[model samples]
Target: MADWQGVSEFVAVAETASFTKAAQRLGTSTAHVSRQVSLLEDRLDTRLLFRTTRRVSLTDEGDTYFQHCRLLLDGLREAESALTQLKESPRGQIKLTAPVTYGEQMIMPIILDFMIQYPDVEIDVDLTNNQLDLIDSGCDFAIRLGRLANSSLVCKRLATRKLIVCGSPTYLATNGTPHTLSELGQHNCLRGQHDYWRFREDGRERNIRISGSLRCNSGIALLDAAKQGSGLIQLPDYYLQTALDEGSVVRVLNNYQDLEEGIWALFPHRRLQPLRVKMLVAFLTDALTNKVL
Candidate 1:
């Protein structure tokens, strides 16, 4: 029989595409992982990977082997998880990812509350705008906003937030509010991250390309600029709620509000997910549903 230890090393390397990263994930030395992979390749009598100074890539045979091995590993993990489920108390670390702003303002608090309830469970959160592959990054799940593209991951809805177009009263007074989507071309639109703004017109979604002297990726910076009467800005309700309530900003084009975007927890489609991941998703869903926004 092939050594299961060697198979695991090969799987890790294949998934991460870096021996150093695989070793770090497995909590082993680079040399140890390399040796195991070498031994496995020798036993199989085929080169599993093409190693270079920069990265490791799988050979055709290796790719086929990895697909089967990953399924086997997943099955093993699921079997173990099934047994752990019987214990009824979830334990272990859950690695998760989320966008910087929302993660900080919304998800982090719920995660902290979950930790309080399950003292034995630990969480590692990666806050970034980049979308990471859950299996490649070894993350249990990710919190995503807006419409998701086609992916193999399973998604669970947590909440929905409306998209709003707004600007400071001064900005609207000076530049005039856009009454229709076509009028947007006549005004300066402060952009955040993307140059296109989403809107709904006549039961269809439309993306309008916007231009201005000032552009930023930070939502807070854009909001600040909008509040200072720089230009009209489009953002989600969560970001503008306080400003709208305090009369610092006013929502315009209410009729053009984009479809409400959903907040979702996305995870790998596995037959048996760990109890900690399941519980966290359930907890966040409940907590977010109770939130007014």
Candidate 2:
């Protein structure tokens, strides 16, 4: 019969890649750690590690076992954490990533509400237009403003947003409103949406290739341009709403509007999601759905 303690030592050694380090982590002597691993190998009838004076490396079976064992242990820890958190409000630093524009114009309000409710939880929000590595950067969750292209990361839809072209009344008087996408080619159409403009024609969604003297990845900048009459810009509804309602920017091409884009919260796929991430996601969804943001 295989001793679970011995198996645990093998797993620790595989994780550390050093028996001495594994022993330190396991709070045991080096000899005991080595003996446990050796006994586990004997019981399993296979060598789990290739030991050397310099260091250690896992064998083929050991490599596969290590992955499974790590998942099992980590999943167990997360499961227990979930139970513990059910009785208490989630409290901890919730690391989040979001695009610069959406974070400021849309998510920030929701975040403020979340902070008010979970006073014990601290938020670390990274507002960048770049795609951040959630695992490498230690982000608990990310607010992605567009349709998620990566299948590897798990995503949940929070809300849907539409893009519309708008321009200040002053700019319209000078350059004129575009009746069609073809007309936009003749005017300064400030672009961003990954440098591609969303359009719809004949009941089919399309991307319009556009350019202008001013281009930016940030929606806030795009809105500012339209406000300044620098150019007609396409922007998400949330950013344009205040401008649109106040008549600062007038929406054009209302009939031929593109399909609504999704706002999603994404996390790295895992057997068990951390409590902080789940709370944040729920808070954001609730806050937005309730028209708080």
Top-TM-score structure, candidate number: 1
lDDT of 2 by residue, 1-293 (tens): 34465867877787667888778877889999998888878888887899788989999999997778767777777879868777677777888899886788678988888888889889899999888977556677788876778566778888788878889999999998889888878888887746668788999988888878887767787788889999888877888777887899998888778888888888865424667668878878876665521
Model 1 poorest ten-residue lDDT run: 267-276
| Error of model 2, residue 152, in angstroms | 2.2
Mark the 10 consecutive residues where model 2 has the least summed lDDT: 268-277
Inter-residue clash pairs, candidate 1: none
Give the deviation of candidate 1 from the true structure as CA RMSD. 3.4
Candidate 2 global CA lDDT score: 0.80
lDDT of 1 by residue, 47-166 (tens): 999999988999999999999988998999988878888976899999999999999988999999999999999999999999998877788899999899999788989999888999
Query: What CA root-mean-square deviation does each model show from the true structure?
Result: 3.4, 4.9
Off by over 4 Å in 1: 1-5, 130-138, 147-157, 168-177, 186-188, 212-214, 225-230, 266-272, 290-293
lDDT of each: 0.89, 0.80
